[model samples]
Target: MAKTFASVGDLAEKTISFTELGPGLHAFTAEGDPNTGVIVGDDAVMIVDAQATPVMAQKVIERVRSVTDKPIKYVVLSHYHAVRVLGASAYGASEIIASEKCRAMIHERGQEDWESEYGRFPRLFEAADSIPGLTWPTMTFERRMTVYLGSRRVDLMHLGRAHTAGDIVAWVPDAGVMFSGDIVEYRSACYCGDAHFGDWPATLDAIAALRPKALSPGRGDALIGEAKVAEAIALTRDFLTSTYAPVAAVAARGGSLKEAWEACRAACDPKFADYAIYEHCLPFNVARAYDEALGIDTPRIWTAARDREMWAALQG
Candidate 1:
């Protein structure tokens, strides 16, 4: 390995913000770090995505305590990523819910993902020793599931494959709000290391059809208006398209991976150079785009060693 990940030396902590989206829905955002959604109900609360570790998750618990005294009885996982799902133990939620595919992925490559992400995100997993093991869902669903928190109804649905093959979004019909897990991002670069680029656009359309009045994205700030929601969704689409188009063109012409990386940078740097995680996410995104363009239907698993090898090959 000739080069290290950009996140390795990022020791500075971000200022966390707890934003209220609606009556009881809130979002916990930290600059470009992963965000968590909060859903308070008549009976208890439901956490959308757990942070990277139990100690890291304590920040979210403190924020939740400030708002409601209701116990968090449900832990909902949006995807199987280690940085998102590994903090379930801190919540002590009775029922941890996720999609069937999400659980399958956890069983398949969750450990490798844990190692891969821990090296990539040194700051996010500072308390890596506190994590017990991989997180598994207590409750798994196929297409959609409806859970009633007393009078409020929250619908968890697998809209489509965007960020990962098994990503779910939580919709609160009464509040007209959606907690879109990495499926949507606002002013932040979407991580595509384990993504489905070909199927991501259609998934964005599905999110658009929801017509959410407010949304809690996976990163950046909380969207609190219809126009802002639309803008975020559109920008997310643009980010995806801008990233894949040039790489696809390069791949079709039998170009090298370095050539594809340069093409992606030339196309994306003008518009998204300043976005959060742009440098950290670009190499992985370019690699995935190059693979998808070459008819690789599934994204290859990323291990700690593979991350170093790929980084050296592309970025060195």
Candidate 2:
């Protein structure tokens, strides 16, 4: 068994953490891999961000079953990333929910993303053959959607564009717990292949304003206390700022994409040296940052071939 996947620079192991965020909410975080949130309600359960494969999702399902026997009635996708939604079928949720923009993104480039991510990190896509097909949302909303699990209210809000144009945050008001998809990561590389680098900070500000007592970020350990929650958000903000600022500055000075990539690497390498997937993510992150810094708000599509070309260009 391949216990870990470290690409010369990434320092994180494939570790999973099951945290009790509140009375009936939990977070399953796996280093820098996609995290899954569990909400146990009076009638059933709701899961946020299924893993990349049915086999991998079963690990999350096992943990959920350890806590509650309630059937999973809802599976909320934070975005259209293949690693985040490919395992939706495993949850068997009655409704698969996402933002309208997210659904549209899925319709637009979901297949290409699947191939792109599988190529970039094969270890994360274990049991790839088990994926039935491209996962689609059964229900989608333009702005906000309030889902009730019996009497408990779970509000899914599209705060703003950060990681992607359709990123959504799941807020359990009663629990004071927020499940921030890839919008926030704790000591994890912020993958920016399809990111809005310029607008990402504003999105983080919206999340910080929530003052969550506990937060389940996309990676690393779940934040249990208010202090830790703030730290996670702060760390994520710092990482994004450090990664984009220098690259943008270089781009403004008529520097080439390759130069901007090196600048980004030089500036961020020391700051985020200990962060997870720092190496594997920086090449893609820098490429997007360079583009967004030049006023390209919407990120370019990243197919498997494009990913390799970008990586090779930025790397050399």
Candidate 3:
């Protein structure tokens, strides 16, 4: 029998966690599902990376109500991915924010990405019809910006590009915590469909420079201590290098995408086979790496048809 494509086979729901890293700072994690970061301030709350749909995002809202009755004031987008941003409506916040480039990417490829991702795994978009089209940032920044949920200062910066060209991290200086979107995943696979393999490490370095005491990574459980935080960063870098190295080597020798896929599996499966969405991410990761190795600077847009074509050709 043939294997299921992307996350179509992943139907089993994961256990969710709402962990506090500091006073009023919480991370909403669902096993290895997409994680949401919460910052409850003196007057209101700010949500980092809205869930995939209004229905799905309601879960996060419920958790926020458990801790505070304050209204959600801002929605900070870490990057432009359908799984992360499509749930903005549920927040009912005054401002929806993201980097300017992220907003452009949404205009450029958001529809196709939405179609591509929704097709990949309908489970994430729990109530697809509930999504009010693509989520847009009512506010945008170029490199750095800050939001004050009252006296609390939350710094949002586009440290460097890793997961996506416009990826940003939300930093809370007083609490020493950062909500690193997919740029830093925990035990989950880094979905590299739009990743920049060559530039990922420096982005990781920029993140390490902040010396965060804790992090709510894109997926997996929250990292609570500096040591655990360091481990997560290190492991994320390892996962990226281990994946890119073998695939790049194959492409350097003029190998085919299929060859690159096989090479990447051999090198990474041993170490990352158990990771959440590992199987789903491998094909996209290899394709992007192969393109980057051949001097492709920008990642090609992924559409639903293109996704099917790539998966069928790679047989991944």
lDDT winner among the candidates? 3
Q: How many clashes in each structure?
A: 0, 0, 0
Question: Candidate 1's residue-wise lDDT over 1-316, tens digit each?
Answer: 1145847867789999999999999999999899999999999999999999999899999999999999999999999999898988999899999999999999989999999998988899967899999998999999999998889999999988989999999999999999999999999999998899889889888988989999999999999999999999999999999999999999999999999999999899999998988888899998999999999988899999998888888864
lDDT of each: 0.92, 0.87, 0.93
TM-score of 3: 0.98
Candidate 3: tens digits of C-alpha lDDT, residues 176-236:
9999999998999999999998899999999999999999999999999999999999999
lDDT of 2 at 72: 96
Distance from true position, residue 152, model 2, in Å? 0.9
TM accuracy, model 1: 0.98
Query: Could you arrange the candidates by TM-score from highest to lowest?
Result: 3, 1, 2
**Model 2 scores what on Cα lDDT?**
0.87
Off by over 4 Å in 3: none
Please give, for residues 171-258, the per-residue lDDT of candidate 2 as tens digits.
Answer: 9999899999999898888888788877888999998898999999988888898999889888888888898998999999999988
Predictions: Cα RMSD each: 1.4, 2.9, 1.1
Local distance difference test, candidate 1: 0.92
